[model samples]
Target chain A: GDKVKQSPSALSLQEGTNSALRCNFSIAATTVQWFLQNPRGSLINLFYLVPGTKENGRLKSAFDSKESYSTLHIRDAQLEDSGTYFCAAEDSNYQLIWGSGTKLIIKP
Target chain B: GGIITQTPKFLIGQEGQKLTLKCQQNFNHDTMYWYRQDSGKGLRLIYYSITENDLQKGDLSEGYDASREKKSSFSLTVTSAQKNEMAVFLCASSIRTGAGQNTLYFGAGTRLSVL
Candidate 1:
């Protein structure tokens, strides 16, 4: 009965491979946001979605409230992208529920 | 084009002692929030303020107190430093445009140590 669940808790990839991280929610999510916690422990906002898809550079994300899931795809992974990725969902009451996170390590 | 700064990046206290963490934002946002993050657990909201003098408790508000003394600053106090709750505390802020919730920005976070 997890409100927000993230799959593949941890991931390891070669420098140039691609991968996808997923989040499934039981709550009626109104919005979704993706974040990256870098090695220095800085929580950097990567993407914000309402109900569709968005692409920023090599990072792309999609949120489908109808299906109760979200996805973040990383293309051509690099050493700098080695960090933890988290997805947070906002409900109708304007409260956020966070996914545990996906620890990604892009090996050189 | 703003920054959220959390003071005393690291906090250490004796068990059952009172500890305080401070957050200041230059974005002049309307909403501010406090969240606690454990090692493997995701971030959990503790408190939030919509306006200058308003305060609302989040899911994990127990044993924690927060203050929105002004529009630019918010402070959180640990009623009693317990070893179980020793983790990183994150402070964030966002502007509510009335249309919807805007992007939430977070600080570097403060790591707490209970001795």
Candidate 2:
């Protein structure tokens, strides 16, 4: 079984729309980090959470340690938001377990 | 903000040849990592260093050697390139985690091709 699993392997959203991405962890994760890999292959850090929620501009993320899951929500999606999203969890040993990833395409 | 620099944005090598990749970070972070990403696959950890002169093997450490010669730099060497092998190697660094919470800063990555 995968230690970290991301939902909706791919997503398509219209500009100005809102959508959510999710990641579930099978291990006892202590912290979680989300990243967006742009077309240029640069992985931009989005959020780092520990059993709580954090918001940045048009993005919001939440991590639930007890439930072993994390969610990333995008508001007012734009063309530039198109890319692959990844969520990684840090376990007790301080090692990261990454999800396969979700490819998102925001159409204009 | 600090930056992580990876040398040789692209690398081409022959089968059985040993290739080396270098990473330098200006963040002065204590932990550095190396990950391999194949086309359409998730990133897999190859090796990590907690401090200078320290090395830890990850799940995919076989055939790979890593060294942390200094606090600001880490290097990885592929003992032998396999024919038709292709992948992107990513380098990342993070602050020491005493509370178990730290975010990783990544470099642009180095694409490797073996003929």
Worst 10 residues of 2 chain A by lDDT: A36-45
DockQ values, each candidate? 0.77, 0.79
TM-scores for chain A over all candidates: 0.98, 0.98
| Candidate 1 DockQ vs. native | 0.77
Give lDDT for model 1. Answer: 0.93
Best by TM-score: 2
Segments in model 2 whose C-alpha atoms lie over 4 Å from true places: B97-100
Model 1, span A1-108: residue lDDT tens: 779999889999999999999999999999999999998888999998999999999999999999999999999999999989999999898788899999999999
Q: Which window of 10 residues has the lowest lDDT sum in candidate 1 chain A?
A: A90-99
Off by over 4 Å in 1: B98-101
Can you give the lDDT of residue B25 in candidate 1?
Answer: 98
Q: Rate residue A17 of model 2 by lDDT.
A: 99
Instruction: Work out the TM-score per prediction.
Output: 0.97, 0.98
Task: Report the Cα lDDT for residue B90, model 1.
Answer: 97
CAPRI verdict (incorrect, acceptable, medium, high) for model 1: medium
